[model samples]
Target chain A: MIRAALFATAALALPTHAAAQETPNMPAATSPSPGVWIPRMQARAYLLENDQTLLEQDLRIEHGLARDLSMWAELPLYEGFLDAPRPSDGEFGLGALEAGIELRVLQHDLDAIDTVRGAVFAGAALPTATDGFGRQSLDPFVGAAITAIFGRHGVNAAARYTFVTGDTDLPLFIGDDGEDVIGADLGYAFRLAPAAYGEERVAAWYLTLELNGAFTAEGDREVLFAPGLLVEAPTYAVELGVQLPIAQEGSDRPEIDLGIFAGLRLLY
Target chain B: MRHPILIGACLCAAHLLAPSCTSTASTPTAVTMSYSAEPLAAGEHELEVHGMSCPKCVSNVDLQLKRLPGVDAAVVDMKRGVVTITLSGNARPSARDLATAVSDAGFTLRAIDRGAQGGTP
Candidate 1:
């Protein structure tokens, strides 16, 4: 689950998540290099627009379907929104469910060419997390991005626009669908520790700057900005960071939200 | 000022320019081995140290030992949890240096076996 606090999303704000931690989340749907394939459990907390926050933990399975493809399925083990009305007194309800796939179109080994390969990616976010917290019936989004790598530096720029049916059976919640969403990211990573044994893992530490904006199909606009960090090891990795909303328009929602995310993947 | 394109471009430029400053010449790794100041006997020594977990760990230990001023090569079979370091010419790393490198890598060297010692070969 993309936890609320981890992503720093406000309760009332739209979904403006952080950088592409996954290669599927990589530069794009093109040429991706062989990266670490990690499987583990993760948890994150989201700060919504209403000053309310929701934290979720999930058993997540993220597999690098291919150099340019990643498949992930997350099942919620628990969920709690700090500011939103509690769904129940105890942990008994269908939580927001989600599953998705990310595709990379281009990428290359910077080590060989010394030039980081560029890439593009397209993917969809499914409404798989249960509707317990804020999971709507359907949330289908499409996005594209490009990434460039320098020796120990790089940037991944992505734009994602999700078209929601604006049809959550629930009324108070307006799904992000119909809200043309766009996210652009800039990130850099340096090798804190060089891979001397086995094969070299890509960059060791990565920091990302991300900005996302959404203009409703109806001409309403809202934007969000987020940044985060990541550390990679041979068979495992650790990451931590926060997201803050920078600009907002055409909405009654607050202009800012906050969240935190962290996880590691074991490369096969 | 959200200039990912500009930022990406600059980064691409830096990545391209960095190697030029270092010298178009690739770093040449010299494969010459020298024995340490102190030479070891043809036999073995029982030495206790740290840092040896998996096969990869063994590789690092081997890399460290083989570069010994006097030692020639080292082999670590992680499954067996043993490392065999051998040298022919002269110069040998002090037991302290060997133990330190192993410990720094997060492993312990329980013993060093030459032929006479009973440690794992």
Candidate 2:
């Protein structure tokens, strides 16, 4: 009876937030809070292509909406690495931006836990990444994810589906200019090294190594992998790494697209 | 940074078949187009370059290679301990310099197979 009441309250309070399909990135439904700290903002980018030499860039921002949930938007910036008089040298345009949220279903710090830790997430992403960048029109999507940390080992898995409704532009990656969008992210992170966290003057410091591989539901049937290190402090963290595009997906041109990037993730 | 929540779901299907992925006993799976067990080659050595054990090491290696002259695109086959280079216009590599680059990036140059004889650019 209480669960039904809670559902009713949620339905009336947040109707649009309800996801059509559950993605691993999206956690189970939950309430919202201002968060232990203020919401944070992050910027990250990626350069991708096939062996054919095609190119694409991704610029994105992610922010936490609550303690266990964070919202994000991504824009597939700068494509056409092969275009023109150095087409690769061009201005920044609208990249595919997605407005979605991620929830942390489970959170625990166990001393004897080794590396066994599991957390779940799921949310909705409105195709806000941008229609101008050849991205799809306004569409709604959903996804879910579960990740665990065991000993020095870390593992995660997730899936998502984007339903097609409004105008259709057949987004890139997918072979068709169709009416739907599908995406998934899976990988792992190992705490190869550990650093300190928080101080009297600061929150903390943390250092660790990681590895990850991901593919999407669209034309990108690729097994993209990256390994790198991260330095985390109380207020923020920095991650440096590169992408190795060893696999190709769909009609996506095949080219050796490589990139070196740094990212800022803060919990402000 | 946080361990990406996406990786687990993406490789879940495969992990079911190869549960030994992170174990010392784990064997490198089919990573090359030719599908060879002893995949590492000479010009480049990739002997299960352990120690990294994370996604970031993959990125670090890519960064280390781009700085090389002859190396056009250095694609690291993470799960396979292989690094494939797309050389440009007869870009020759000095084994000593190549080894240093790999070592500085924090990995072992198990082997380098001049990459496939022919595949698109």
Candidate 3:
């Protein structure tokens, strides 16, 4: 059952929830390259009650290199507390550097309805962390994502699989929860503001919900439901969300009672 | 420990300062003047779109429309929420196809006006 879910998500290849589209009434998880450069800094913190805290600061840049192709790079600083009972043994270091390219696969327009968009992407994560905080070796991943919009409602789906290459015998870290990992997310976004469109730079708000899951080859699976609010201006956006674990099984990984994500994105 | 803080500070400063440096280009006066009233070429169609609230939304529309198989060019008018699409030689898409592309980009197709040059038969 875990493998099946993994495969299903791997096939979808959805975009990260942090990369919402700038357009109103669009899905928040599908990355859209609007023929321009987009630079985003995302700060994420995860807290496990009585367990650990994970802090991530990522510098991400994406550009539409061509009409149908876009490339992106992400540099992250990760700070997290592992399973150590001592309070001071937590680790902080540069996390994996990731780079990827996405190709628009399908885009179609309906006569009286909204449009549909699809894309496929492939990327690699390079080990750059200290003290086993990241995958100690290079990890490659590929996935597909699709989005559909209808007036003020939109839905997005994505699946991806990462081929892990880390020292399995090393001491475990919170980031080392898996060997091969499959991840997927299903999200819906509803426009909350801007009952009517405007000509100048418009500020729109959206209420979003996402079902996200990660499946590991080691039989560990973690699933969460996240509800968020997104605000978009002309060239920037701010998003805030909370993730609550719905199901967790297998592996000794401690369940996160609650997690929060706040992000800011900019386009140029 | 200080890296995240430093970066955050710098980003915050940039975000606050960018408006002063680049506000003129996106001003309402500038946006209204950008509406294209140019004539469409043969096999061209114009889509009066809805719900495109910003320049980024216009870009999204352009990106998705140009991804269609037969499309050669897509121009989005942010001022009017209009998109002009041109088809390649001997290629065409139905109204449904156009609507689907716009919808996929998270916009509505309010109207499709055939180009004055000629319609695809």
lDDT of 1 by residue, A96-171 (tens): 4446665543333222112322333334445554444444545444455655544444455666544453333322
Off by over 4 Å in 2: A1-33, A36-81, A84-89, A112-132, A164-176, A179-182, A195-220, A252-256, A266-268, B1-121
- Across residues B23-97, which tens digit of lDDT does each residue of candidate 2 receive? 311111111122332212324333224333233444455666667676667655433455666655444455445
Q: Candidates' TM-scores?
A: 0.50, 0.45, 0.65
Question: What DockQ does candidate 1 have relative to the true complex?
Answer: 0.02
Q: Measured against the native two-chain assembly using Cα atoms, what DockQ does each of the candidate structures obtain, in the order listed?
A: 0.02, 0.01, 0.06
* Cα lDDT of model 1 by residue, B6-81, tens digit: 3455457545744552332111101011213234564444433332322233334554455557666665543234
Candidate 1's TM-score reads 0.50
Error of 3 at A4 (Å): 39
| Winner on DockQ (1 vs 3) | 3
Candidate rank order under DockQ? 3, 1, 2
Question: lDDT by residue for model 3 over B84-116, one digit each (tens)?
Answer: 778865455666666656655545565667454
Tens-digit lDDT track of model 2 for A110-136: 222222222233333344534324444
Give the runs in model 3 whose Cα sits over 4 Å from its true position. A1-35, A49-51, A81-91, A111-113, A168-178, A198-201, B1-55, B59-80, B83-121
Please report the candidate that would top DockQ against the real structure.
3
Better of 1 and 3 by lDDT: 3
True contacts kept of each: 0.00, 0.00, 0.06
